[model samples]
Target: MASRYHEVYQSWKHDPLGFWKTAAEEIDWVSTGEKVFDPDQGQYGRWYPDWECNTCYNCLDRHVEHGRPGQPALIYDSPITGRTASYTYSELLEEVEAMACVLADHGLVKGDRAIIYMPMIPQAVMAMLACARLGVIHSVVFGGFAANELATRIDDATPKSIIAASCGLEPGRVIAYKPLIDQAIDIARHKPDSCLVFQREELAADLKPGRDHDLGALQAEAVVAGRRIAPVPVKATDPLYILYTSGTTGQPKGVVRDNGGHMVALKWSMKYLYDIQPGEVFWAASDVGWVVGHSYICYAPLLHGCTTVVFEGKPVGTPDAGTFWRVISDHNVVSLFTAPTAFRAIRKEDPAGAFIQQYDLSQFRSLFLAGERADPETVNWAIDQLQVPVIDHWWQTETGWCIVGNPVGLGLLPVKPGSPTVPMPGYDVQVLDDAGHPLGANTLGNIVVQLPLPPGSFPTLWNADKRFFDAYLAEFPGYYKTADAGVIDDDGYLSIMARTDDIINVAGHRLSTGGMEEVLATHPDVAECAVIGIADKLKGQLPCGFVVLKAGVDRSHEEIEKELIKLVRDKIGPVAAFKIAITVDRLPKTRSGKILRGTMRQIADGETWKMPATIDDPAILDEITEALKTHGISV
Candidate 1:
């Protein structure tokens, strides 16, 4: 089976256009054209340029039309709100059509952008589908983003309407979203003509007259008026959505995904990467704001006629460390996908594997990790605890889907502890030196993809095509600069070492901070760890490590720090200069569990740093600052 998969991959590499043309036939295109790919058109490639289709029809309506109307399409589980609901294919279609009518009734038409700022509720998914149904471009901001951050996105997108919920239910608290939306509207110069609020009964919000309207009430009115909003057939090149990702310069770039190519690639991924079948449950424990959520939680599973779980609770909160196991066991989830940070948290809170043993996870077949590089320690730990293959894949927000992954849908390959397996069928991944020359095996260099990025990948930035070209395409003439450093081993497996910026130049030798962090994570005392480079006059830069110890493990900070330093020297080599190690109660992270290493570097360098809007806890930053100051380090 593995050989067969490799054969398919080779065929794709040999004839990329033929591969995509075959895949395109699987979708319900309104008018299938002969064009497969256009690479020289304005220098940015476009896929299936002359095709026409509706994304919602491919995701929702087609499944219902094929006599699978009663099949379960969505399973919403929100422990915070104590709600569990299931929607069938037919039911989801009705809800989506009703919401589409409501959107149309509000004077929203094709080509208009709608900003959706809501939690992991059913409405969020419905709103996204409705936008796709009407050919309206939707931009979903992370629910945890601050008003200023939201305002920045609004100003850039200039959305015609905004959809939000009253509040987001977290553990023991309700985060008021309406107030933030209102504040962002006040701050942003380009205001939306309309605001639609989904009033969560747990915490209702005030609606501004003539500006804000009730989403549910509008849907009800549309239903009462017997409005049947059919899916709009849009050109293949029409923009589907705009997702904003942070740039190194502190500005955000809106990555644009088109309808036809995105639909084809995502639908293929559902069966090809995850090995999910119709009616099986697939749960991705990520927020809707992120790309993982956009692909897996909302679109991919539904596109393949599978039941996607929309989880509205944290990995550790609203319950306990066993929250993930419980969700999988209760829902019979076949494929469980999440970040490595989540597993690290669960391992920290319950190290003995006690909580996990309480549940029957036999239904869970494979566990996939992404968002950040998966340390070998965490990957091996999950494999041992779950008794299943833990596959670590790599992709970016710009790509919109997995570029490097183990095709579990075909067969399980030999597990490489630190590698994210081989490149998928469409990605021609290569490691290039700073001068755009290919590097040898085991040599870390910038990760780049050869020209003609696969379907479903972002074609250009929204309203900033030049910025996109300068940021990605222009760096290497015939390659998309990934801005990540990695190496391909002798076995052809790619190991992402670190972000290019995260590589510390110590004594003219490049050291991967991520590699050092992985080494530190192997220490028995360490629960979670992050490494950042600080300016050093003698060595150019030195590695600084922050660690969170396992719960209930009472060990002296000095003792653990000493062990960690030696661990890094032993594993990564003595040249790492990994002397400084500070034990923190918790590492600063975003709500999505990404470590804030940049913020840590700012504090370590004694430079002024503004608190990021996406930070999960501002107090943790203060704690880190105080800890550094206690060590007699100048801050």
Candidate 2:
């Protein structure tokens, strides 16, 4: 295994195109064709049409054929109900076959789409794989989204059916997901033909009047038939999924991706970036909805034929913040991939030895941090507390897996406090100015992908190919504009500063407004908050925070400001402890729950904000302006 990995590494380092082509041949393709690059094709220039492979075949059948059918493929845990389950590869295949048979029984055939609004459970994974097996594109929405948001995605996809769980577990709550699904279906102008419901906490009291099917009944009824739905013939470019990205207007962008490309990208990523081994149990703590989970947790690990842990609950549950450690102990996970937000949350609840000692994490070999920025404090905290190398990676929904990462030790050459490390092999990443000229090392500029979009990069926007290209490609010719501000240090290590819209340089140290907001929200009294760095003489720029207290909680100005600073220090580091952290009544956020940091920045910098017509709460801006003046931070 080591020798093969070495060959892959050397080949990739020396000749990326040749290495990827060789890796491409590892999978059984439907056809063999070669068109890796074509500059004239513009945004959609790179197409590999000569190859074809179903994700299920690569993830399941191939592994089973290699004499590893009985190996455990998945382990799941639900903290709320205290339930646990496990599935071996063969057993998982059986579940997928059974679910596929059920779908086929309902006349849903190949080329159909299925929207899965289910919780993090074995059934959810099964349904997804079953859709893959049946050649039905699956789009999964986050279970916590409001009904309107859910309806928009469902409408966009126009799926034939929805596989939903009755309920799901969050921190200290059991969310009724089925009811949400019902509400969405009612609000949806275009509804699916059927609904497959899984009962976890409580059965739906009022089922939407339609072709409502109980998952348990269907599984039980189909088990005796011993039938498997025949796999469909799929091309490499056939749409495999339509992952909806959150949009500012609540209308999500359906990120359509192909099966073969996703397989190639994810397989290579897990093998190279994460060094995934067959027997290893990989645990990416992100929910299945996000891009990270879609790649690492669900698709990537399976594509590599490895065991994975899928927790059907949140990281922080009751019993005083020892939930994640307990899950790791129970599952004996070897690798953990989680967000910096989760790690910070754990630290906020308990930053001592007893909580850390409650579980055995010695089995872990690597820990990956994504879904947000990883500053020095978070990195050092993981290293000191968990005693494992924390790999901080940078990527987006469009780029797919860790295009830039510090691969275990070989790439972990040196650590920069806020840098996201170097780009991985096969990625030609660059930082360029607005005029498309490459910027010098250590010069902050727009991050751009110099090469064509790689595998797992969205094949196209659903019904909006022109819009997709115009948004990503038209901004810069022959490059994919990342819209992220970054800097390549003198040492050639890549450090992502922040989103260009929200980044602020304070004392020469670039900070993400999102990162500061996350830290401020750590205060017990703060229910929500936003932060923006305003101009300052001494520091160049300093952060000014706007905080919203939890209902029925009263906090004084000095107390809130002090707590916010301390929270930033404790969660991140002293560098994040800004000199001007203040509290406000509310913040200006987009309809999709993202804070309008640009507007806040303007407000902090003493500039008038031209409120857009769609501002959800225009009054919030006035409140923020008044509060800042009241706090005596106004210019």
State each model's CA lDDT, in order.
0.89, 0.73
Return the top candidate by TM-score: 1
Worst 10 residues of 2 by lDDT: 1-10
TM-score result, candidate 1: 0.98
* Candidate 1 lDDT score at position 537: 91
Q: Which lDDT tens digits does candidate 2 get at residues 1-635?
A: 12243344466768666766766765766566666434455355554665666788777877888987999998888776677888888888878888888888777777898988776788878888888888899998776567877888888888899887887666555678776787888999997899888776544534656577887568767766787765676877777888887654435678887877678878877766786787788998877777776787778888888888888665455445688778787787877888775665565456553587978887877788876666565567677888877788888777667778766534344556566777666567898877889989888788888656777677578877888888788888877778888789887788766688677777777676766765665566765566778888888887777776655565577877887777777776766547566666556753223467777777768876566322446888888778778767673
lDDT of 2 at 540: 84
lDDT of 1 at 390: 95
* Deviation in Å, model 1, residue 335 alpha carbon: 0.4
lDDT of 1 by residue, 38-139 (tens): 876544779998889999998898999997899888889998878999999888888889899888878899999999999999899999999999999999
Give candidate 1 regions above 4 Å deviation: 224-226, 247-249
Model 2 bad stretches (over 4 Å): 1-15, 34-42, 409-412, 504-530, 533-542, 546-579, 583-635
